[model samples]
Target: MQDDALFPLLSALAAVYAAEPREEAGRTARHLLEAGPSHLGAAHANDAILAEMAAALAASDHPAVQAILAGAHLLPWGDNPVAAQAAAAGDIYVVCTLMGPDGPIPSDDFRMGLFWQRPGTYYALHSHDADETYVIVAGDAEWTAGDDTRLRGPGEAIHHPSLMPHAFRAGPQGLLALWRWSGDVNTHSYRMLPDPRAVAAA
Candidate 1:
């Protein structure tokens, strides 16, 4: 059945995090494996943007990437109104939390999911109390945090300390990354910073 597809992706993603050397990421991963899966409602499905990202992930040979692609459609997809506006300007972003408050699989302390952005898009700076990590599954991107900025590629990972303002721009090929959040998982605490691009010019 279609619902059964999430388990493999969950398993593979948890395995990757479990093997991670970072204590917080590893702890969250282990907890995710133990939490099991949840049935997402119809609200989670967004066929247009998600379908395209899923296809890209499915083309990968990585087990975790392919597993997530298998069930991407069934998972809940969400977007920010401001970010959606950028989509109207030809930039796009789609996210689905696998665990935690907004995700299908609910948990008290951790959140995990996928984030997809179209080519030539900029994610503008944002910050949160929860520590976060992203494992790039496909494509490349230039990620920025304050004075720090680096180009990242598939199979690479980035960690952002809690409350650190950060953002990233999708490359010509776009970007698809698996992300996780732990500690202070309150979604209300998420805030968008002043546009760094604008701040620089001023």
Candidate 2:
């Protein structure tokens, strides 16, 4: 939470990364990143630099940007999970995991790697601090706002600027998407957040 304490975590990780063989560390980082920042889900973004990254993501075209622009742009990583999932899913899988979105912290901005959905599922209603953009990479998706609906396919996108009410459901064939948190997601808010029925009914 505090700048003074942040370095210790980084230092611990750095120490581990330095001591491990390069190949092993590389493998480890890949695993961590793939896990979608859920571990640091609410922690990492607390940093000033991370906060800026969120904003950069908010204002840029992802998977196709050159550098940080308007202080809020980000390009997709080549070995990014979407590429990997698309490769394995034949253009129809949920295509893999949710984006490793940067987390909470006012002074910071963030980006979401990519968040897709499996066929026939509702992502539930959610919202965050940074404005965001979702680009459909493959297949189709349906985003909902109250009673309104927007359907999209590859190359199509939806933008939700901070606090706007929204929700998504993948198409019958699933969805592949890229996302952006157009500003600091220092305070992500999910509307009607997920809550499964605790009772199992027959």
Candidate 3:
């Protein structure tokens, strides 16, 4: 049952990556195409935000965004494995890995997935060993990397080098993005840094 939706979802994502100008995007596209359809069962959680994410994606004009929304119901959504503490802080987000080591389509060296965050949520500063890139498929966000910050909307891309501190606050409509990780793609090194606002208050 999941394979029915997974195939089209992955195919659509491949098309999205193939159209990107980055070499990494091209490689990700090839990986997706080679993986084919596979099922990992439903990993769904945080049901409340799923509907909001779907609504935001549905409002987007991007084709990739529309494709994601169409297959969202079948995707294996799950919580953040690396930062469990974030949930306690009311910073909730979900992930659906289409291709990666733990995903239905296994790839040790890279990971490609979708990420959705609730509206007005702030994901505090964090860093990891993996080199990551996120392309906004729907909604908007204020992304911060080190000292730089920018308001990013649909179709924009943000890159974070290995171990570089980064964070983001979702816009009123929330955020829906396609993300990929490569180079030291291990969650073992993932760590959340102290929130600057808290530090300032102290």
Ranking, lDDT, top scorer first: 3, 1, 2
* Shift of residue 62 alpha carbon in model 3, Å: 1.1
Clashing pairs in 3: none
What lDDT tens digits, residue by residue, belong to model 3 across residues 21-132?
8788898898887877654566564567678988898779877776676678776677344545444444456777777777667788788788887887787788989989
lDDT string for model 1 (1-202, tens) is 6547866766777877876788877776776667666545554666677766765665555547777767677666673322323333234577766677644666777777778887767777888888888888877788886668999877777888898988888887678888888788766667777784735522
Stretches of candidate 3 off by over 4 Å are: 1-4, 43-46, 83-91, 198-202
Misplaced by over 4 Å in model 2 are 1-107, 191-202
> What are the clash counts of all predictions, listed in order?
1, 13, 0
User: Model 2: per-residue lDDT, tens digit, 41-156?
Assistant: 22211233324333433443433222222211121223222243123333222222223342221112344444445565565555556666665544565776544678876556
TM-scores for all predictions: 0.82, 0.43, 0.88
Each candidate's lDDT (Cα)? 0.72, 0.42, 0.78
| Candidate 1 worst ten-residue window by lDDT | 81-90
